[model samples]
Target: MEGGVMKEEGNRLAKEQRLRKAVYNAIITLSECIVETTTLQRTLNNLDQSSWMEVVEERYLGRMCGFPLCTNPVQVKNAQKYRIDLKNKKVFERSAEIDKFCCRSCFLRSAAVRAQLEAEPLWIRGDEQVKIFDLNAENVRQQQQDTYDVEFVEDQQLITSLEILKIGDTAESDDEDNDDETNMDEEKKDDAHKEFYNLCQSYLTMKSAVASIDEIANDPTVKRITDETVTKMEIEAERKDNKRLSESEKLARIRSKYSQNKFKRPPEIIEAKPFNSELCDKVPENLYQDFKRILSEWCGPETICHLQLHRRMNLSDSENKTVTEAKSIIAQFYAGDRSINKIVEDVFLPPVDNVDQAKQRISVLVELLKPSWRLLERTLNRNGCGQQALEIISTFRLSATNVILEKKMCDLAVAVIFRLLAYCDRSLMDFYPSDHIVSSKFMKYLEQIRCDAKCYFGILSIITNKLE
Candidate 1:
């Protein structure tokens, strides 16, 4: 008994060791499988980060076959795939490389349904069939030969009966006497004559009424002038007569009444003597005569004499110095002096607060200088004084710097310079070369002035081109 018990214990020990070994092997195998699966999962996740991998996932992963009644997952498996051509009503087998339905049964089922639909007659679901049947019945009834034949036969019978009745009535009328017929015809003629006479009377009365209406319509005096129109005409006529008489009679009466006054000679007139010699000597000797002439032309002799007398009275006081300076400048310029810089300094340097007033003053001076400049140009050209003309132009060009600071003065200066250039081109080109010293100086001054202000760049360009 002891030996059996020991053997049983040993057997139990061996069974326990075997069971433990099996359990340990199972645990190791499960751990290795888990590590392999995790590594594969990490690899798949890394691949899914790429765009093409995502497309592959969408193409195959979690996508089912696009086939009717198909529940199989689309994959590279044992099933044959196909594509259904709905337009051609055909089914074609596709390679496993293509992404489409996975099963041939689905394609075949779809094709069978398409063929069945094609084999069936075209169907209308509303009352179209009933209406078509009714139309066909109506057409068949119209096409039956008996229906129209019967209607035509009845019409012919009715027409024959009407003709027979008309013949019988004619025969009965023929049985009557010709005298009765003649009496009836005479009665009809009398009635016709009476009606015609009545119609003729009515026509004549209507024609007379129409003629009277036309006469009334054709009357010229229908639209007589209103009282207002007649009054206006009378007023106009009276205005004309009054104007004629007033003009003629007023002139005649004035001539008759003031004839002595018109012909009367004034009391013996005393002419004022010329300006005092001391005052005349104040102007330069060469310019005195021209100054006196210009002063007389600009201001009358009486005014000039008054200015001279005033100057003489205030000889020591510089109160009205501008008037004297203006007189001297004008005199000097007209006397063939081209000292425009000094003239501008004297005339244009006095600052004016009012721009409009300054512009007005500049405009007045420009107008006054224009005639002198024109006369000078003519005299210089006639005497062939092209160099003197250029000197005068240079003086004006230097003066334009001060003038161009004002907008209006700049525009006027541009116009005057353009005119001067034209005059020089016409009158002085024969004497001077294209790139003469005067022309170069003038162009340089023009470029300088143009740079200083934004004025007449176009005209400057044109002048430069012409000079070049």
Candidate 2:
């Protein structure tokens, strides 16, 4: 009884399984028919260089492939496992496997070709559009420029108005204020320019050591070739000299006969007497002192002579004061008695025999001038003898050695130095030694006179005039 029941159950189960299989087959067949008629598969004739396409090899299984030959699961159409034989260009849609053939890759290539063709028109259209846009943009830019030119003056006026409004809010609204500051700056610059001009002018005034500078520029003779060229020329010259020398060998042989002649040898040393303190003592004390003082006192308004004299005499400050007092007494004596021209003549061309005599002459000159200058000042109201008197006073200051002389000498030295500076060449100013005592003293004198740029420049002009 159990065997019959079990056999019946197995038969029923088998029938049910067969029925399920038949139904699944029918559904697949209908799906294949639907896909075949739907025209879902496409062929591309002009594939673009870069595009994506899918090639179907099987339906329902979703088997596909692509160019450069890739396979993935894809759907098939027409109840066929579509396969591509790419070399043949034939589409096979069936459930049969073909040798060395892929449906997908061929379809993909066709699709890509079709896509490339389709996109060509769109790319051409885009490029044309860009060109048209560029032309329009250029036209617009030109129109804008024309418009700007038409309204240029108005625009400038508007800008000026805006600037004026902005300026009104600032502290520096006054144009004159700006002008004043500008003038100040210009004045400063002018002063500097004048100084430079004065320097150049002064150089022009003075005698130029480089007198041949311009001639050197213009002269063809000045330019020379290289040393090697000169050497070559010399060699050629030597060759020419040697051409004559060959014939002179006979003369040379004649001269060789006298070569044995010789001259005398002289003694190396000679002796003389030694000592002479008595002769040294023969130099008179007053003479020595007087001789020294001329250079010390008489260098025309420059106290450099006096300062140098003191230094050379090696006198202490106290001794210098005594010397100065004695000198003043001599100057005063000459001033009360002597004539100005006589003093002037005496100061420069002193008796050269003794220092005391020279001192006496210098004293007479200074003394004669001092009171005469004062008298000239009093007498010459309309005439310009005051200038001569001033000059005389300057000369007197150099010789006189009192407290008054120190200040007066300093002032006079300054005047003389400045006056001389005007006559100095520009190159000298640029290259002369600043460390030199005379130069330093001269500059110090300029500072003392409070000489400004214009005054110095006037002096320069005077110098240039003299030179011209």
Candidate lDDT (C-alpha), each: 0.42, 0.41
Task: Report the C-alpha lDDT of model 1 over 1-468, residue by residue, as the tens digit.
Answer: 999999998987776665445434323332221224333222222111122223323434446443323455665566557789999999998754234446665444433322222221212111111111111223444545455675333445445544644545645666766554445566755665576566557755876676676575566664344555788999999778657786778678667865465565689989998879565323233332332232223232222232233333344434434446766656555545444344445445445574544344445445444544444345333433333333323333223323322332332343334344434344343323443323443344434333221233333333344333
Show the colliding residue pairs in model 1: none
Local distance difference test, candidate 1: 0.42
lDDT of 2: 0.41
- Which candidate gets the maximum lDDT versus the true structure? 1
In candidate 1, stretches whose alpha carbon ends up further than 4 angstroms from where it belongs are 1-266, 271-361, 377-427, 431-468
Q: State candidate 1's TM-score.
A: 0.14
Per-residue CA lDDT of model 2 for 1-468, tens digit only, reads 899999987876776565445434433332342323112222122121222221222232333332223333333434536878899999986544321124544443434333333343322222222111111234455655786785333445445544644535434635546655544555755665566566556656566565667765565554454455788999999777767765578578568878667877987886777888666434233432342243234443233332233233333334324446566446546544332345446556445565555356445555543543343234322233334334333444343353123323333333433343322223223322432223454444344434343444443343234333
Candidate 1, poorest ten consecutive residues by summed lDDT: 124-133
